[model samples]
Target: MASGLFALLDDIAAIAKVAAASVDDIGTMAVSSLDDTAAAAAKAAGVLVDDAAVAPRYVVGFSADREIPIVAKIARGSLKNKLLFLLPGALTLSYLLPVVITPLLMAGGAFLCFEGAEKLWEKLTPQDESADEDAAMDPATRERTMVSGAIRTDMILSAEIMAIALGTVEQEPIAEQAGALLVVALGITALVYGAVALIVKADDFGVFLARKRNGAVAALGRGLVIGMPTFLILLGWVGLLAMLWVGGHIIIDGLAKFGIGLPSDLLHAATEGVAGAGSLVAWLVEAGSAGLFGIAVGGIIAAALHAIPRKGH
Candidate 1:
């Protein structure tokens, strides 16, 4: 009896040890997975920034009560874009048409360049007719137009995000890749729209504060009301810059993969030249050079697009 009891205790101890080790293994895996996902998200910052920047325009004309709801709707569409559409499609592409990733990336990059250039062109050559048409539209029609435009833009930005995520998941197992992509999609959707919600409400917040009795509080509120519009305009410009920079980088990288190495070569040379300037300086120099290349490429594409003639109505 004594011998048997001692044997049972030993068996229990061994089982506990095994369970502990398994838990440790799982914890390690979770950490590693999260780290990898974060890195990939960082790599796709361009798309993320552009998405945030573009979403606010969708809610511009809506009543205060409707703005958040509209943003919510767009966010839902964005999720469907990634999880329902892009995720499975990306997996298929990875296994079946891996070679096409570079070309597809370049295509998306071209799209970003086109969009940025279009915005710039619109600003420089404002058309009174279009402005008049917009001003003439009823609230419902304007809202519809804005929602459709936002969804269409979301499709392109979502595609770019998925591609960047897919590229980063190359080494992971298929299941892990899918999980990571879903996480990234949901996370970014929440983040972008959440910020939009706050931005849209900021004016209301300012007005509420302005009604308060305290002079300092009213002054702060007035500042917010005055500053928000400028901030948004600046945000739009920044978004355009981000799109061009990111798009250019994607095209250049894609080109390098296909044996055209000029962009990477230039980046490397610049990095080396700035090596003695310290790590931060070197990194900035490399990024700045890449951005310049992106701007040049975007400009060329914009010029070509303009040069093409359109059909008469």
Candidate 2:
């Protein structure tokens, strides 16, 4: 009877060891998978940052209370763009028409170039637009317009980010690809909109602080309120720069995939040449060269667009 009991205990111990080993294996696999997914996500950082930087513009005219709610709605729409629409579409494209990815990426790049060029043009050709127009609109109407515009912009950036992420994913099981994409999409959207919420509310926080009796705190709050507009403008410019850099990089990479690798090659050589100078210097040189190339390409395209005649009988 004692021997029987000992045998049973040994059997239970063996089972426990097996379970522990299985759990460890799963943990190891998950860690490896997460590392790969993170690298892919990092590759799409330019688009992600641009998305976060651009979203605040859409909430410009809203009341303080409306800012967060509007951002939440836009964030929801962005998620829908990624999950309900883009995920299935991307998967189908990956499986059915793998060749289309390069073309699609190039198209998105062209779009980014066009948008950046348009913003540059708008800046160069200033118009005195009336704030009263926004002031006159009902809150609901304004909110709708802002949400629509934001979603449209988000669709473009989201497409680029999704494509980049999809491209980086290995030819793993479809489930793994899906898992990586979902992680990237949710992570990016949360990051962008969460930052947007903080940015939009920052001035209000400043105002609250300014009401405090402490002189230094009130002064700091005053500075914050005063600086917010400039900071937003700076953010807009940074977004444009990101668009240009990301757009140019995508086009260069796409062209290389299609066997036109000269541009990227030249950029790479330039980057390498600057490497001996210092890390920061090398990076700036590379980025500046890329940005200049992007600007030139964008300008040429913009010029060609202007030269084309509009259709009107």
Candidate 3:
């Protein structure tokens, strides 16, 4: 009996040792996955910034009290779009249709170019403002419609973000790809809406501080009040540039993969040399070249589409 009891204790000890090893293995995998997630998210930085920049426009006409609520609604919709809709589709493409991913990414890149160029086109050739459809609706109704519209718009951007993110991890195991995309979707959604919440409420916060506080605090409030509009305009310009550079790079790089290498050659040549700070210069030149390429491609696309005559107006 004594010998048997000792044998049972030995067995328990061995099991515990195996369990500890398994736990360590899992911990290592988790860390590696997180690193990949960060790198993948970085590749989509352009869309992420534009998402943040474009979100503010949705809240512009709402009452102060409604701003955060509207942002919250859009945030919820964006999450649903990423996690429920785009995530599975992205994973499916990576697993089953891996070959199509590059062409799809280029399509998205072209879209970004078109969007960026269209914005420039609008700026250069102003059209008479159409009356807003929501003008006749009650405030509550208008808010509902606006929230729905914003969500629809967010669906497009969220799809792009997910596609760009998944493209980065296409070679990883399916589980790892899922892990990276999950992190990106959750992280970016939080980042974008959190920033939007802060932006929409800055003026109110400033007003509160300006009225209810004094001295340095009050001066800070005044500064926020004065700075928010300028900050927003600057943000719009930044978003445009980001779209152009990122979109252009995607197009030229994709073309290189298909044996159309001239644009890619230009991109490479623009950044081919570097010594010390020249690396920084190389990065900028590469980005600038991509942006210019985007302008050319996007301008052609924009003009071609514009030439299509409008009907039934």
Candidate 4:
């Protein structure tokens, strides 16, 4: 009886040891998965930044008290689009038509470049402004319309972000790929909306501070009110550059994979020839070349599309 009791204790100890090892393995995998997801998501910065830049527009007409809540609602919608819709669709595409991922990604990249270039073109070209009569609208109706528009826009950008992320981890196991994309979807939505929340409320914060009697606080508040616009403009510029860079890189790399490597090879050689230039310079050179290529491609596509007449018209 004593020996049997001792044997049971030993078996229980062995089970505990096994359970501990399994837990450790799971923890390690979770860390590794998160790390991989972050790296892959970073590759999709173009869409991420565009999402961030565009989001503030949704809150423009809202009262200061309602800005954060509006952003939160949009964020929730964005999350739903990503997790419930985009994530599963992306995973299915990755699994079923693996061969199509690269070309699809390149297409998405081209679309991004086209969008960024279009924004630039619009900036350069003057528009004929006709004075249009305004219809009176209730505030609630306006807010609802704005939120709907923002969420609809987010759906497109989220799709691009998910596609880029999915392409980045196509080689991973399906489970890992799903996990990575889940992380990216939640993480990026939070990031973009969080930044938007801050942006829309910044002026209100500045106003509050400016009302303070303290001289230093007032100065700081004034600075914030002054600087927010400039900062937003800078962010837009950054987002445009990222779109060009990322789109260009995707096209160049996709072409290289299809045995048309001349452009990339030439760019690489030219960059490499720079004496004492490190990886950073090489990356910049590559990025610049890619941006130029993307812009050219995007411009041609945009022009061609513009030349076509609409069927309904």
Candidate 5:
């Protein structure tokens, strides 16, 4: 009876040891997987900044009362786009047809460039005030139109974000890949819309602050009230350039993947050849190259698109 009890104790001890080893292995893997996800998420930082920059303009021209709601509507749509559409599509493509992903990313990027260029064209050629249909829209219709447009833009940027994440994690086990993409998708959406909400509401915050009892606080608020518009204008320009830069970057990457690597090679060479320049210079060179490329492609697309409506008319 004592011998039997000893044998059972030994068996239990062996099982415990095995279980401990298994847990340790899983812990190591989980840490490594998280590290990879963080690295992958970093890759999407460019598009993420562009996403945030692109968002605030949609709330422009709306009444103060409607601004938050407009932002909310767009945020919901962006989340939906990421959680429902882009995430699953990214995973599916990774499994079945990974090769097509780059071109699709490029296509979306081209659309972004077109959007940026068209906006620039609008800036250059002011519209007739009396003939502005969208401006003539009722408040509700205008909100819907703006929200819809914002959501559409979010879709592409979100796709880029997910695709970038997918590229980094495609070699991992399916579960880890899914987990990383999921974390990125949720994290980025929360970050972007949260910042946008703060931005759109910053003026109100400023007004509130300006109305405070403390003189210093009030002065700070007044500063924000005065500074917000200039900041917004600056943001608009950033969004525009971001569209081109991101779009151009995506197109160059796609082209390289397809064996048409000249643009990518030249871009690399140019960035590397800058002698004695700091990291900032190299970054600017890359950005400028991508922006120029985007402008060229976007210009062609914008011309065709603008011409089509006139011909139809």
Candidate 6:
């Protein structure tokens, strides 16, 4: 009886030890996974910045009261796009049809370039008088239109973000890749929409503070109210540039994958050939080259569209 009891106690101890080790392993893996995801997400900073810069414009022209809710709606749509549609599709493609990834990425990148170029063209041209009339006519319709447009745009940007992330972690096990992508998707969506919420509301917050009795508070409020428009205009320009650069970068990278490596090689040699050039200079050169390439492609597409006679015209 004594021997049996001792044996039983030993078995329990071994089991506990095994459980502890298992727990430690799981904890270590979780930490490593998060770190990897963060690193991968960081690599896609250009797209992230463009995402942030483009989001606030959707809330423009809305009443102060509707800003936050509109942002929230867009945020929810963004989350759905990333998680529900893009995530599974990305994983499936990465696993099953890996060869197709590059072309698809280039396609999406071209769409982004086209969008950015169209916006630029609009900025250069005068707005139609009917645009003002439409804005004054139906608030609900305008809000829905803006929200739909934003979400559609978000889908393309989200696809790029996820594809870049997947490329970074392609060597990992599928499970780990899924976990990391989930973290990235949730994290980026929250960060982008949260920042946008704050941006759209800053003017209102400024007005509130401006109405306060404290001098400093009022001054700060006034500053925010005055600064936001200029800041937004600057942000718009940044967003446009980001779209061009990131889109061009994607296409250049994709071209290399498809046995056409000259562009990438030339870009590298041109940048690296600079004497005493550092990483920053190389990066800037690469980005500039990519942006120029994207602009050229986008310009051709835009001109083609312009050539096609519309129903009204």
Per-candidate clashes, comma-separated: 0, 0, 0, 0, 0, 0
Lowest-scoring 10 consecutive residues by lDDT in candidate 6?
A: 1-10
Candidate 1, 1-313: lDDT as tens digits:
1122223323322232223234245455544555444434443666666677778887876789889878888888888888888989988887778888779988888778777767777767967664456668888888777777888788889898778767765555566556656666766677677777887888999999999999999988999899989978877777776677777778878889989998888888989998999998996786567667776777788889779998982
> TM-score of every model?
0.83, 0.84, 0.84, 0.82, 0.80, 0.81
Cα lDDT tens digits for candidate 6, 253-287:
88898889997898778787863678778767877
35: Cα error in model 3, Å: 11
Evaluate model 6: give its TM-score.
0.81
List model 2 lDDT by residue over 44-138, tens digit each.
56566677778888888777888999999999999999999898888888888888988998888877877887787787797778666767788
lDDT of 4: 0.73
Candidate 2 contains a number of clashing pairs equal to 0
Q: Estimate the TM-score for candidate 4.
A: 0.82
Model 6 clash pairs?
none
| Cα lDDT computed for each candidate against the true fold | 0.72, 0.74, 0.76, 0.73, 0.74, 0.74
Whole-model alpha-carbon lDDT for candidate 3: 0.76
Model 3: C-alpha RMSD to truth? 12.0
Comparing 4 with 5 on lDDT, the higher-scoring candidate is 5
Give the per-residue lDDT digits (tens) of candidate 5, residues 117-210.
8877877796877767888799888888889999988888888777766766566556655766666666667667877888889998999999
Better model by TM-score: candidate 3 vs candidate 6: 3
| Model 5, residue pairs in steric clash | none
Estimate, for each residue in 1-313, the C-alpha lDDT of model 3 and write its tens digit: 1122223323322232223234245455444455444433443666666777888998888778889989999999999998899999999988898999889888888988989999877767978779877778899888888889889888887887778767655766777667767766776677778878988898889887887556888888899999989888877877787788878988887899999999998788768854345777887888788999998888888989989989974
**Model 4 per-residue lDDT tens digits across residues 148-236:** 88999899888887887676567667776676677667667766787788788888899899999999999999999999888788777
Candidate 5 accuracy as lDDT: 0.74
Q: By TM-score, highest first, what's the ranking? A: 3, 2, 1, 4, 6, 5
